[model samples]
Target: MNHPIGEQTVLITGAGRGLGAAIATAFAREGARVAINYRHSRNHAEALAASIGPQAAVYQADVSDAQAVQELVARVADELGPPTTLVHNALANFRFNGEARKHLDTLQWSDVAAQGEVAVGGLINALRALDEHFTTHQGGRVITVGTNLFHNPVVPYHDYTAAKAALMAMTRTAARELGPRGVTVNMVAGGLLRTTDASAATPEAVFDLIASQTPLGHVTTPEELADAVLFFASPWARAVTGQTLIVDGGLVCD
Candidate 1:
């Protein structure tokens, strides 16, 4: 177990289901007090918190709303203590099925902007809300979830991939800006996960195909990717920042 992670409070955005839920579970398993942030998945969030026992609690906030995020921080601080580790995993409405995806010909800037609102814009909001707490505490961690499509362009998910790429840029930039305050900002980019809410619409054949092409001979799961995310928050990565760890079963060598 990492030194301080097991003793700190963690805030995981969009943790009602999917990849976010996996992250929350990972934190709790590490003995971190988990604050599960969800926008619309109340039932799922409550259920998850319950299953995690007393170490977890659920909060609702649209990460894109600055005011909401501020309020969220206050609530979590009151209930779970000010979060020393933040996982900005909130994603806009998206499905990972390539067949049902928008192609470059039919894609629109608005589609891309919507994702940016959540990916980049939401990150700004979360950071703004947590910056003071982070600097004051002097040892906070910011972990953003990203995608591996930037290198492979497997399905050409124009909007989703573009937004995540922008997120990676922001991740690095934030690392530089926040590093002096004794904080580390990093990203975990995972390939098409074997099963998550966002990837549920993907065709079975696509999963099978990806598995066959991977060096590990299997598709990555949300839990597997979540474990890599844990690494960035752990003491082992104390000297690391401004980087992306790709967890896709070696499908893309990035």
Candidate 2:
């Protein structure tokens, strides 16, 4: 049940920029054929595909939409072969400014639902589309992008954190169900990435404080976190599943 990284076809959702872009680069560097799935950021996605050479291509898809995901998988299969790895990195739109965020009192259920629709719903769509491919091949890998906020709750981003928490739960449940089919499901949770689009609005003081508290003495960069994701998809992780690997420089112990 060894899944070699170099030979895999990887589809990464929301890979046009930020942490998703970094993850796509990491996989391509390892010789994986990559499909960069983006809801917007078409220019950036195309540029990234070009930079990654022939093994990578840009695809536009709203991962939360079942029909769109079906079409996306078809396109990826036609262009890059049926994807053996799926990275759920698509994020719902939100700013990182804690002061500007809505607290529990003002945060509506729809706000949380929006994030859940992307986080949880996107994973469901991908799994359904890839089920046949995985079964035919007898193996596959599912890597989900999550935040460490659930463990540390440094800012208590209620909507975002809650949705990610649910995603983590779903990841484990999926692992249990898909394990017999040889599809391993796991999550990679990171702290506030150094400078992704989502974290750009975070004040410098906040970054400095997080860095000071981290055992590594610096905020984790998306590239660093992306490498951890690569490990999960590699052959070395064949026996691992239903787990969450926190990649925030030891900022939180889980």
Please report the candidate that would top lDDT against the real structure: 2
Worst 10 residues of 2 by lDDT: 1-10
Candidate 2 lDDT at 53 equals 98
Task: List model 1 lDDT by residue over 107-139, tens digit each.
Answer: 999999999999999999999999778866876
How would you encode candidate 2's per-residue C-alpha lDDT over 3-27 as one tens digit per residue?
6899999999999999999999999
Candidate RMSDs in Å, in order, are 1.4, 0.6
Which candidate number has the best TM-score?
2
Please identify model 1 stretches exceeding 4 Å from their true place.
1-3
Backbone clashes in model 2, listed as residue pairs:
none
lDDT for 21 (candidate 2): 96
Stretches of model 2 off by over 4 angstroms after superposition: none
